[model samples]
Structure formats: C-alpha cells, structure tokens
Target: MTETVTLTVRGMSCGHCVRAVTEAIRAEDPAAEVAVDLAAGTVRAATALPRARVAALVAEEGYAVQD
Candidate 1:
C-alpha cells in the first residue's frame, strides 16, 4: 500500500529550493508523486518510501527535514 508523508523542510528560501526538494524525492522514488509548497516549506508525497530514506535524500541535497 502507498503511504503519504508530509515533511516540513528548512532552508527553502525560493522556488528553486522547492524544485530541488521535489527533484530529490522523485530521484529516489521515480513513481512517487511529490507536491512541494514553497510558501509553507512543506513537501507531501504519496509513495512507499520511508521517512528516514526521504530525510536522507533531503539531507543529501543540503536541506534539513524538520520533525
């Protein structure tokens, strides 16, 4: 079953930051659907990807995932 996760992200100062986060998540799970809200600095994804894995992907892109 697909799971949904909402992650609060830090260091997203612009649209580029949103795009980067979106890309990073998609890179890890090609079939995952990702929606990044730049204003809210949150990313919501529908997939089976684990939270820890997602956090790692964001960290790899030099961003922090707020718990």
Candidate 2:
C-alpha cells in the first residue's frame, strides 16, 4: 500500500536541494509524488516506500531528516 511520508528535512536551502530531495525519492519510486518546502524545511512525499527508507534517501542527498 502507498503512504504519504512527511519529513522535517534541514539543510535544504535552494532549488538544487529541493530537486535533490525530490529526485532522490523519485529514483526510488518513479510514481512517488514529492513536494519540498524549502522555506519550511520540510518534504512531503507520497510513496510506497517506508518512512525510514524515505528518510534514508533524503539523508543520502546530504540533508538531515528529523524524526
């Protein structure tokens, strides 16, 4: 089943960061819907992947995903 995973991500300061996060998640699930709010420092993604996996993907892009 698919789920929406919302993460509080830090270190996203520009479009590149947003794109990195969005692409990172999309690379995992091409159909995943990703929205990044740089101003709010948050990422909201609709994906089938587990929350931990999503967070890990974000972290891999050099961002901090808060619990």
Candidate 3:
C-alpha cells in the first residue's frame, strides 16, 4: 500500500532546491507522487518507498528531513 508522508526540510532556499528534492524522491520511487512547498520547506509524497530510504535520499541531496 502507498503511504503518505510530510517531511519538513531544511536548507531548501530556492526553486532549484525544491526541484532537487522532488527529483530525489521520484528517483527513489518512480511511482511516487511528490509535492514540494518551497516557502514552507516541506515535501509531501505518496510513495511505497520506506521512510528511512526517503530520509537518506534527502540527506544525500544535502538537505535535512525533519520528522
């Protein structure tokens, strides 16, 4: 089953950052539905990927994912 998660991200300063995060999540889960709110520095995704994997992906992109 797909699960939805909202992660509070740090260091997302611009549109590029938002795109990077969105791409990172999609790369981890091709079927994931991702939405990033740049102003809020948050990402909401509906994915089958595990939470730890998601967090790692964000971290790899130099962003911190806050629970």
Candidate 4:
C-alpha cells in the first residue's frame, strides 16, 4: 500500500526550492507524487518509502524537515 508523508520543510523560499525538494524525494522513489506548498513550507509526498527515508532525502537538499 502507498503511504502519504507530509513534512514541514524550512528555508524553501522559491520555486527552485520546490523542484529541489521534489527531485530529492524522487531520488528515493521516482514514481512518487510530490506536492509542495511554498507558503506553508510543507512537502506532501505519496510513496511506499518509509517516512524517515523521505525526511532524509529532503534534508539532503539542505532543507530542514520537521518530523
């Protein structure tokens, strides 16, 4: 079953940040669906990967993921 993970990411100020975050998540699950809310600083992703893994990928992009 697919799981949906929503993470609060810090330091995302523009569209580039969104793309970066999306790419980071896709790095782990290429078929995952990622949605970015710049104003809310949240990244909602649908994937089978563990939440911890998703958070780690977001952090890899120099973004803080609020668990």
Worst 10 residues of 4 by lDDT: 21-30
Ranked candidates (TM-score, high to low): 2, 4, 3, 1
Candidate 4 residue runs with Cα over 4 Å from true position:
none
TM-score of each model, paired residue for residue: 0.85, 0.96, 0.88, 0.93
Cα-lDDT of candidate 2: 0.94
- Every model's Cα RMSD, please? 1.2, 0.6, 1.1, 0.8
What is the C-alpha local distance difference test score of candidate 3?
A: 0.86
Structural RMSD, model 2: 0.6
Kindly give the number of clashing pairs for every candidate. 0, 0, 0, 0
Q: Assess candidate 1 and give its lDDT.
A: 0.83
Among all windows of 10 consecutive residues in model 2, the one with the lowest summed lDDT is: 1-10
Candidate 3 — number of clashing residue pairs? 0
Candidate 1, run of 10 with poorest lDDT:
12-21
lDDT of 2 by residue, 10-57 (tens): 899999998999999999899999999999999999899999999999
lDDT tens readout by residue for model 3, 1-67:
7999788889989878878888999987889998888789888889998877877888899998887
Better of 1 and 4 by TM-score: 4
Clashing pairs in 1: none
CA lDDT, every prediction?
0.83, 0.94, 0.86, 0.91
Any runs in candidate 2 off by more than 4 Å, and if so which?
A: none
At residue 61, give the lDDT of candidate 3: 92
Model 3 C-alpha RMSD vs. true structure (Å) is 1.1
